[model samples]
Target: MNAPLTATGVRFADTALAQFLCTNRYTSLDELRQTATAAPRRFWHEVVTALGIQWAKPWTEILDLADGPMWPRWFVGARIDLYDNLVGRVAREDPNRPALRWEADDGATRTHTYAELDQEARRLAAGLAGLGVQAGDRVALYLPMCPEAVVTMLATTRLGAIVVSLFSGYGPDSVASRLQDAGVSLLICADSFQRRGKSVPMLDDARAAVARCPTVRNLLVVARGESPAATPPDGSHWHTVDYQQLIAHVPVTQGPAIHPADTPLMLIYTSGTTGKPKGVLHTHTGFPIKAAQDQLMAFDLKPRDTLMWVTDMGWMMGPWLVFGGLLRGATLVLFEGTPDHPGPDRLWDLVRRHDVTHLGLSPTLVRLLMAAGPAALPDALPDTLRVFGSTGEPWNDGPWHWLYDTVGQGRRPIINYSGGTEIGGGILACFPGLPQKPCAFAGPIPGIAADVTTADGQPANGEVGELVIRAPWPGMAAGFWQDDARYIDSYWSRLPGVWVHGDWAQVDGDGHWYIHGRSDDTLKIAGKRVGPAEYESALVGHPLVTEAVAVGVPDPVKGETAVCFVTVADARRLAARPWPEWERELAEHVGTQLGKPLRPARVHLTRSLPKTRNGKILRRLVRSAYLGQAAGDTTSLESPDALDHIRQCRPAGA
Candidate 1:
C-alpha cells in the first residue's frame, strides 16, 4: 500500500478533491499511482463501475497491455456505441431538460433538450448512412458552434464513424492537411459566419480545401450569413432541413451495441507548427471518465452548476466542455460571438444571465481582457460563480491575481487544467482542497501518474524540467490517425519508456506545478535560455502595456538576441507626458517586472500584433519577419497586413 498524503493546508472550494483529501480514501499519491500501475484492469474496472457506464455487453477481460506497448485493449468484451452513453442513457424523467444553449453573434439564440439532441443526432445518422457513411468511415466537421455541429458530432458517434474536427477559420492548407491525413470522405460546414460585424466565408475555405484534396466525396453546407457566391461543380448540396426536422425522419431504434471502452468517441486534431497535424483518437469510456473526473475534481462541477467554456468546435476545450458537462448532468452555456466583440461586457453579461457556476477561459483571453483596462470589467462576479478554469497556455501572475482578486474576491480557485487532446483531459489540474496559489497548478490528478524530470530522465523537484506521464491512464489516445509510427516517434522517442508531453515545467517544494511553456519554443540567447512567453508575461504586467510578444533575432555576439513587441493601451498619452523620462520609465517597468537577465534587448511599440482569429499571437511569424525569413502559412492569419505594420515599427537598422 502506498503511504498517505497530507493536505498541506490548501482549501479553496467544496469539491470532490476536497472530499477525497479529507476522507483519506486512497492514502498517498503513490497509492493512487499504484492503482493505475499495479493492476491497471482492476483500477479501470473500479472507475467504470463508479461512473455507472451503461455497457450494452459485458467485458470478459479488462485491459491487455502485456502483448505490446501500443495495442492495449480496454474492456475486451464490451460492445457499445458512444451515442447510447451520451444520449440514450440520460435521465428520462425530464425529457424537456435543456442540454445545449447556443447564442449566435447576431443575437440569435436556440436551445436543445436532451431528447431533441438525441433525435436530431439519429436523423443525421440516417442522413449520413444515406450518404454511404459506414461504421469506420471518416467524417470531417468544419462547422461553427451551432445545433448542426453538435448534432453532426453526436451523429457520427452514433454511427461509429470517426469524426475529425477542423477549425472553422483554418485556411485551405490546414483543412486540406487534416482532411487528407484523416482520409475524410464527407465534409460539413456553413456558408459563412458573423464575426465582429463582418461575414467570414467559412464555406469558401472548405470548398478551397476540397478543391485541393479530391478524396472528399460530398460537401454539406449550412446557410448562416448569406448564400456563397460560388460552389463546387461536382457533388455539393445545401443543408435546408433543421436538425430536428431531419431527425424526425429517422426511426429511434437503439443502434447496435458497442464495447463501452473499445469504441472511439472523437478524434481531435492536435495543433501543429512544423509538420502535419496528428489526429488524437479518444475512446468512449476512458475519455468521458477523465472529463467527468476533471469537471468534478478540479472545478467541483455538479448538476446544479451551469458551465461555460469560450471555445470553438475545433478546439479540444469544446469537446471537453461537452462531455464533461453532460457526464455530470450539468448545464452548458455556449456563445458563438467573440468574447470581446460588440462590447467587452459580452462575456460578463453571459455569466450574469446564465448564473454560471464554473467558467473556463484561456489565459490569453484573460490577458486580453486585462489589456482592455480594469474599468472595462465589472468589479465582481455573479453570486452563483464559484470557480474559474484556465487552460491552453501557462498564465502570468498578473492576470491570475487580477482574476482572483477582482472577479473572485480571492475566494474562487482557478482550476488550471494542462493537458492535450491526446490525453483526452487534464494530466495536471488544480484541486479545490489545495491552497489557491496565484499562477500555480495544484498537482497531478489522483489517477494520473505525472512527474517533472530533467533531460537525463531524473526527477527534478523545485527545478525546471520536462513534464512527462510516468505511467499510462485509461484516457490516453489510441494513436495518431493512420500514423502510428509518427505517434510513437513524436511522443515516445523523447524518452524510451515514459510519455513525453513536451511542456517545460517546475514543481515547487510544496509540489505546486508551474508550466513554463512549450519546450520547442524555448529560446537560447548569449548561451542563456529563456521562454518567449516568460518575457511576454512580464511585459503584460506593466500598467501601460496591454499585451506583449517576444521573439529571437540573430545577433553577432549573442547568436540570438530577444526582440520584444509591446502594445500599450494609451502610448500617445505616455509619450506626451515626457520624453526620455517616459522611455526610461517603460524600460524600467520591464526590468522591474522580469529582472535584468530576462529583459528584452530592445523593445518596440506596435499598434497591433498579427494573430489568428482565435487570438493566438503569431510569434514565429513575428520572429521570421524580423529575421528576414519567409513567413510560411500566413493564410490562416486573421489580418495578413497586420504584420506589415509590425514590420514598419522595427528599428531602422534592424
Candidate 2:
C-alpha cells in the first residue's frame, strides 16, 4: 500500500483550521471530529452561535429526532428569513463592503456594494409584491449568472416566495417542464447574453416556454446586451414588462417578510436519472445555514476572501455560491462565459485580475487545460490565491496533479468537496489544515454522520461500499416537491435507517476517505465488483490518454465484461502507430496494473464522452449507446453528439 501524504509543519501551522482548533481547545482534527459526531445537536448549536446566525425567534430545541434519523428537523420552532441573515444584516454592518463582482465575456465588469445589493433586492421585492406575487408563490428565474439574477433570487426569497431556478441553457421544452411542474406564477429572464463571443437569445426561449406554461401570468425581461428588444408575441395573455422599468419606481426601504424556519425557500430541480426532474425543495433555515456552515468549516471562508465557482444559475453550485459566500461575508465573483474562451488561460486571467482567494472548478475543466499544455497556464500562480476548491465530478490523478502543481503551485490546499443538490452542502470535504493525498477526502464534514457501509449495513473500511448518512443534517431536502413517495424510495429505501447516497465510497486505514463513483455505475465482472472510476483512473494514467470511460457490457461466459471508451491527448501520435497495436497495448496495460479479470474486453477510441453541462461524464448514456438501447434522460447532456461517436466506435459482436 502507498503511504499517505503528510502535511509539512509550516503548511499546518498557517491554516485557518489550526486557528479554529486552538480557539476551540481541540488538539487535533480527530479530536474535533469525535466531538462533533458525539453530540451533533450541541455541535450545530455551537456552530450557529459562533457564526452569529440571526433568527426572528430563537428555537426552543436544537433538533427534533422523534420522527427518526431520516426525518430529523433542525432549528426547531425558529422563525427566520434568508435575506435577513444573508443580505440585510451584512448590508447594515458593512454597507460599503464589496458584495458582488461580475465580469462579462466582452471585458465589461460590474461591482455591487452590500448596501447597493440590498437596495436592489428590496426594489425587486417591492415590484414582485406589486405584481401580486405573495408568500409561497413560485417565481422562476431563467436568467444567466448576472447581478440581476442574484437580485431577483434575494428579492423573491425576501418576500417569502419560492424561486424556481431554471438553467439558462435549457430549451423551451425543458424550461416549460419545470415551470409547469412548479406552477410558477411569474418568470424573470434576460433578453440575451454573450456565450463564446456570440449573443444567445434567452428571452426568446422564455417567451416560447411561457406559451406552454398556462400558470405563468407575467413575463419580465432584462436587457442584457444591445440585442433587439424583446416583446411578447401576438395574442399572449401574460403581461410583459421590462425588468428595469418594472422596478424603477419601487421603494427600496421595505423589510423582509418573516416566515417560520421550514418555509419553502426555493424549488431547485435535480437533473433526473430518469423521468422528469425531481424538485429538491429547500427552506430558509435548511439550505442557507448548511451552505454557510460548510463554507465556514470546510473552506475557511473569510470576509476578505473573494470566492468564485464556475457554474451556471441552473446548477446547485449557483445558489450555493450566493448564499454561502454572502453568509460568510466573502465577495462573490460571477463570470458569464466559457472559461477557455479567447484563450486557454482565460480562467487564470480571471483569477489574477479579480484577486480570487478561493477558486473552484470541475476536474473536467482542468483536463481541458492540461490538454492545452503547460504553456497555456499563467507564468505564476495568482498572488492572492488561498485555497483551490473542486466538485461536480470525481478527479483523475493526471488532472489532479496538474491542478495541484501547475495551478496552485504547491503552496495552497485543494479543498475537494463532494455532495449533491439534495444535501445542500458537502457531506465529505478536505480541510486546509489536513494532509491530503490525490483524490482523497479528509473525512465527513463536522455534524454530518456519514460512513461507508456494506450491503447488509456493517461498516466497511479498506473496501468500497455505499456512502450512507447515519443521521439527518439541516440541509437534507424536505422531500421532493409534491412527490413524497418518490423521494423516500430514491434515498431512504436502500438502507433501513440511513440515507443511502448513491455513491460508492471507501475509508483507508489511515482515516482518509475516497469516493469511487456512483453506486449505480458499478461494474460486476465474473462475480467481482469494481467502480468505473477504478478503470478510468488506470486508463487516464496512461501517457497518451486524455479521457476515458469504462462500462460493463453483457457477456455470455462472465456475467459482465468491461468496455473502455477513450480519447487521446494527441491524435497525431495515434496515426503514427498502428491503431490495432495501440489498442492491444492499452488493454494489456490495464491487465498488468489491475489483474487479468479486470482488463477491458474491448477498447474503442472516441473523440469525446457525453457529459452534463457541469462536465460529469454520463456513463449510463455511454452504456446505452453501446448496447443499442434507448438513452434515458439525455436532457442534461451537454454534447449529445458524443453519444453518436460512442455508437459508431462500439466493437462488433460481443
Off by over 4 Å in 1: 1-13, 19-24, 27-39, 67-71, 226-249, 253-260, 525-527, 577-587, 593-595, 632-637, 649-654
Return the TM-score for each candidate structure.
Answer: 0.90, 0.97
Deviation in Å, model 1, residue 244 alpha carbon:
7.2
**TM-score, model 2 to reference:** 0.97
Candidate 2 lDDT score relative to the true structure: 0.85
Candidate 2 C-alpha lDDT tens digits along 489-586:
99999788789999999998878888988998999986778989888888888988888999998988998999999998789999778888889999
lDDT accuracy of residue 534 in candidate 2 = 83
* lDDT (Cα atoms) of all candidates against the true structure: 0.73, 0.85
Deviation in Å, model 1, residue 601 alpha carbon: 1.2
RMSD of each: 4.0, 1.8
Number of the top-ranking candidate, with lDDT as the measure: 2
Clashing pairs in 2: none
